[model samples]
Target: MTTAVFAGVDVEVNEEGFLVNSDEWTADVAEAIAADSGVGPLTELHWKVITFCREDAAREGTAPGLRRISKLSGVGMKDLYALFPKGPGKLAAMVSGLPKPQSCI
Candidate 1:
């Protein structure tokens, strides 16, 4: 684990940089993480996906898969790819401050 400062808060992250505690996540933290990940300054559309991922993770006790994120978040697959290039599922989880999805490689 590594301690990182985001939004002036110190939080732990794994080797892959995923948050160790989802409870410590905030919009400011997300902004910092996003910028670090080269994903943002997050847009309103990004916020929609991030908010959906956080809420869904809280309800399910795990991060949602890309298919779930696309279907439920009202963000289509193409748009998800456009919004979070490289790997949408993994990147979305990272930016949303949730643990990496089990389905992610």
Candidate 2:
């Protein structure tokens, strides 16, 4: 485990920098994570995906992948790719402060 300071709060993280505890997640932390991801900034659309990823992870015991996030998040694949860049599911899951999906690349 590693300690990552975000929003002036220290939170635990995995070797990959994904949050270790969902309880440590905050909107401020999300924004910091998003910023650190080089995704520019967190827009409304970005928030939507972040919220969806967190909620889905809470219910499903794992963060949803790109396919599910695109299908159920009310955000399209093109936009997700554009907003998150690189990998939508992976980045969003990281920013949402959930466990990196076992399937994320």
Candidate 3:
């Protein structure tokens, strides 16, 4: 485990930089993590995905997958790629302060 200073808050992270403890997450931490993940700034649309992912993680113990984010969160695949870059599933989960889902790979 490693510690990352997100939004000035030190939190535990795994080798891939995803949070080790989801309970330590906060909106500010998510913003900082998003910026670090190359999202730069969180927009309304970005917030939509983040909110959905966090909520889903809380309810389901994991962030929704890419297709779920696209279909349920209404972000679409292209827009999710544009917003999160790289892989939307991993990036969105990292930004949402949850561990990366197994399906990301």
On lDDT, the candidate that comes out on top is: 1
Candidate 3: which stretches are off by over 4 Å?
none
Off by over 4 Å in 1: none
Q: Residue by residue across 1-105, what tens digits does model 3's lDDT show?
A: 999999999999999999999989999998898788787889999899988988887888766788888888888899999997777878898988888886643
12-86: candidate 2 lDDT, tens digit per residue:
999987999989999999888888778767899999998888888889898898889988999999999999876
Note the Cα lDDT for every prediction shown: 0.91, 0.87, 0.87
**Candidate 2 residue spans exceeding 4 A from truth:** none
TM match of model 1 to true structure: 0.95
Q: Which run of 10 residues does model 2 get worst, by summed lDDT?
A: 96-105
- Which pairs clash in the backbone of model 3? none
- Give lDDT tens digits, candidate 1, residues 1-105: 999999899999999999999988989999999988888689999999999999999899999999999889999999999998868878899999999899652
> Considering only N, C-alpha and C atoms within 3 Å, which residue pairs clash in candidate 2?
none
Output the lDDT of residue 82, model 3: 91
TM-score of 3: 0.92
- Per-model TM against the reference: 0.95, 0.93, 0.92
Evaluate residue 105 in candidate 3 and report its C-alpha lDDT on the 0 to 100 scale: 32
- Winner on TM-score (2 vs 3): 2
